[model samples]
Target: LNAAPGWGTRLVAGAVVVTFMASYALFRDWERFGPLLLRHPTLLALDTLFGALLLVSAGPGSTLAYVSVCTPFLAGLIYGWRAAAVFASLQGLVLLLVHATLDNPHTGPAEALLLPGLCVVAGAAGSSLRQLMLRFTEATRALTEMRARLAVTEAVSAERARLAREMHDSVAKTLHGVALAADGLTRSAAAPDIDAARVRQQSGLVARSARRAAAESRELLADLRRESDPGHGTDVLAELAARTRDFHARTGLTATFRPTGGPAVPPVPPAVARQLLTIAAEAMENAHRHAGATRVEVLAGVHGGLLRISVHDDGRGLPPGTDLEQLRRTGHFGLIGMVERAASVGARIRVGRGTRTHGTEVRVDLPLAALTATTREA
Candidate 1:
């Protein structure tokens, strides 16, 4: 397309050359020479064609020098590097041929021959310059793409950090309170001269709080599990048994847990494990505190593709018309926490006045889907 300007310049130069020839013919012997060449048709044709070629080649001004330089640049713009080089060489050949038969004593044949070489050099330079520009443009585009990806990655990282902070503030605080309450109750139970009932109540409170703390602690850790290794070690059934043993050791409450079925580790998601443990702890605590119970039993197994966890205590049953809501509200963290955790994991948790052994019973039945096998393996 840049060749467009050079072509226009050549056309204007041709028109001016035509005007000059017209004026020169009027004042000189151009007519006499024109008739002499006509007697020889071949010579007349050659002379006329050479005059037209000269006019067309002489671009916008009398300076044919400027035209020689511009032709190659124009060729380079229109035909890239290789074609531009060929055009430059062709222009020199045309100029040499035109100068050969022309009688006008303007420039020498050697000068006409040098014009094409100059065009090739200029065209090559233009090609090199264009290549450099393209390379720089490509580099810029690549940098822009990299920067956009970097921004997206940073945004995701920041969002994860914010979520971690929120988890700490909400779940972490609640768990801490429960743990402190357990420690307080445990210390209270160690006092001397306390009645049996009072001692039992205090011990029960401690066990309940401890269990809630453990559950919450597990939950807090679950969110931090690796994406590639999304599993928590230790089976849920084994965890229940371990907690029961720990409770007995700590409070001398005689807590016992058994899995009724084959040694299949029932799938248990982290949320389900937390809730079931909390519920068991709450059930046993209520029996010991309010019912003066001596034995607590925890039964855990899988039934019909569901995880069943039930806690039964041989303590006195809950009082008639007991305000279960009020009981849950008055720092009975176990009941409320258990329910919340169960709901989170889509488990069906029930706490009622009586079950086997005529004591308070709490049971949680969770769907197999809610209890992930990956979590159990973890």
Candidate 2:
């Protein structure tokens, strides 16, 4: 495992160094020491061989004999600083004792002590170098992770801003147009030979469109509010049902809502809330104006960490547009807006006629990741 700061590494490193030095001292010439090699055979072999080679090639008189200092350096390189220091100190003690008792009886105490004393310094130096490298590596790793997280955050934030702007231009503007159309139809009723039947039909369409627009506006506003104040955490199902009821009350149309297994309080972030509200409102509006529907149904559920909102209206369905962009520019802009919002948040919206409803059905599936970004802001 990477060297995490914990008691385990300290204990293991300490024990390895202490046991290795102790066993080396206990059995300088025992065959049993070979089995102890199984614990950390490579390090044990290297240290022992280096010490033996120095003893053979460089006599006690030569300063080059101190090349055996590599034993502690190797321990530090493999384990860490603390272990390296302990191993170096232990090895130096063993050398001093061996030279005093068996190898250098003719030499003065100070002369015999010089090589072992240098070994102690070399061990400490090795440990310090390893610690510095380890610290640098950890710092670099942490910095890289933080930068990657920041990049994702920035991209999500930018997407949210673009989505908000599009909703204002498309959904909000369409609602404004519907409100104007309703007021105009009501005023024109004062004129004679006005084709009352056609005017009433247009009035109904205008009223329905206005209601959908208002609901969309409210939902979008709620999302914006959530960004600044997350205290009003709405239940997604309740909000959908409430919007449907308001649609019925405003337009004198029959609208129903059914929800299947969702959280009492929507776990959606503010960004998703905005996009979901936009799609639902747009779907309802299209049904009211173009489909001439008397009944509308809103359904909501969760699937695969996504919130799916569906709006179905029972009215005469229109043909799919050949030039979606041209239609949007003329007046039917909400569909385009809804699609863009879904894309911004890594979601998808499906628009089709309902099986039983005999009118348009728009379904939006919003990803949970879009909401996760706003949750932090909240």
By lDDT, who's the top model here? 2
Model 2, 166-277: lDDT tens digits are 6888687887888788777876786676878868887888978877777777877766676556555446777678888888888888888988655533565544555677
Give TM-scores for every candidate, taking all chains together and pairing residue i with residue i. Answer: 0.39, 0.45
What are the Cα lDDT values of the candidates?
Answer: 0.60, 0.67
Model 2: worst 10 consecutive residues (lDDT sum): 144-153
For model 1, residues 1-378, the per-residue Cα lDDT tens digits are 112467776776666577557647833985776555335444423433453455445531235434555545544543468755765665655555555645557766566666656767777876776677788988985564344334323333443465478568765675676677667566666667546776567567657766765676575465445311335433678888888888788778888898975547544443335456777777766767777878888888878656788888777766676565876767666567777666555566787644464776788876554334334233
Deviating ranges (above 4 Å) for candidate 1: 1-163, 166-223, 226-228, 231-234, 328-333, 353-357, 373-378
Colliding residue pairs in candidate 1: 232-378, 233-378
